[model samples]
Target: MGNGAKAQQRRERGGKDAGKGGKSQLKVNEASKSIVCGTCRQSFMTTARAPALTAHAEKHSKALADCFPDFKV
Candidate 1:
């Protein structure tokens, strides 16, 4: 199967895009020690690195506030 099929399956199972691309959607998983992209369910192993995480967030058209509202970016 292709990636599209897998994505469809994830949608059917209500797994992917579960965060709706809003606040708290992008957060660090302490246990896993990774930054998870709630919009696409993609994970980054850089371990909550701000610059890397910010770069990824840009792909979702999200501003710094979406990732961290209290942050002074």
Candidate 2:
């Protein structure tokens, strides 16, 4: 098969295990306007904004980093 065909085939095969691991466990609480981390069960008020959610997620990421120095979230 040609290169383009091979690339298309790979895409059809889900690009070789694209989502095998490393999934986000963050969940949003619409009623309370907060985001909670599934791993740590930590919650923070989001005020229905992206920045707040991002900041809260970063906190969880930092906590994970403390445990695993090389871990990326």
Taking all chains together, the TM-score of candidate 1 against the true structure is 0.39
lDDT of 1 by residue, 1-73 (tens): 9999999888989966686766652354444644456677665564455777788779889964575443332
Q: Where's the lowest-lDDT run of ten residues in candidate 2?
A: 64-73
Q: Tens-digit lDDT track for model 2 on 25-63?
A: 444343563445555665445443545445555766754
Model 1 whole-model lDDT (C-alpha atoms): 0.64
Question: What are the per-model numbers of colliding residue pairs?
Answer: 0, 0
- Any runs in candidate 2 off by more than 4 Å, and if so which? 1-34, 62-73
Candidate 2 versus the native: TM-score? 0.27
User: Best by lDDT, which number?
Assistant: 1
Badly placed stretches (over 4 Å) of model 1 are 1-33, 46-48, 64-73
Q: Once model 1 is optimally superposed onto the true structure by TM-score, how far is the C-alpha of residue 60 displaced, in angstroms?
A: 0.9
